[model samples]
Target: MQGKAGNAYLINELVRLVYLTYHVQDAGYGDTDVVVYARAEAALERCLQRAEREQVWRLEPDDAPMFEAILRQAGRQPA
Candidate 1:
């Protein structure tokens, strides 16, 4: 993976896991689950930070709308 491609991959994977993690939980998650989602959001944020620093490719046009779409699909908001 080179610059943009690498960054895009990281973002894509993080978003996928974030969405998956939320959906796999019970209909009503407890405090622990909140912690879990928080961690996932944090991880996504970290990757996004790297993407900015590394000049990663765009998440929209060129690739999937990993950030907004994934969160929306999971009824989550970026924190």
Candidate 2:
């Protein structure tokens, strides 16, 4: 969450759901930490605005575990 840029988006579901992704500079000095937020890209703009007002903007709680699991399987993790 430090020295990073955060991003968010929505997925067209039964009801639109917002999600967030972030990336921070790699502590060990890589090309820069990068978070590829494919699932949430479509809703990014709105999600960011909401996060600014609410102080929290992340995938809905019920959806998070599954999202993270997918990321892990893909060899990625939230930054």
Candidate 3:
């Protein structure tokens, strides 16, 4: 079994992960970025998966960064 977080908690974490990934990308930590971003994406996916499994809620655009915002935050470069 996996640990679970409330919807509010998940959103907060999602925001953090989004920023953390951008930070890591800019830092150019090589395989370290892979390790971290994989975990971050997995966390996002797992949150949605759990929500679906429990029939509680689904992923909402309101919870995601806008494309412009993501670009701004992540910078205009590949990871």
**lDDT of candidates 1 onward, in order:** 0.52, 0.37, 0.51
Give TM per candidate. 0.44, 0.29, 0.39
**Model 2, span 12-64: residue lDDT tens:** 33123212223321323223124333443433444456578875554444444
Q: Could you give candidate 1's per-residue lDDT for residues 1-79 as a string of tens digits?
A: 2234655666677667666646544444322345556655765565577668866643333233433444454554223
| Residue 31 in model 1: lDDT | 23
Ranking by lDDT: 1, 3, 2
What is every candidate's alpha-carbon RMSD to the true fold?
9.4, 11.8, 10.0
Q: Which stretches of candidate 2 lie over 4 Å from their true place?
A: 1-38, 42-47, 76-79
Candidate 2, run of 10 with poorest lDDT:
12-21
Higher-TM-score candidate of 2 and 3? 3
lDDT of 1 at 30: 20
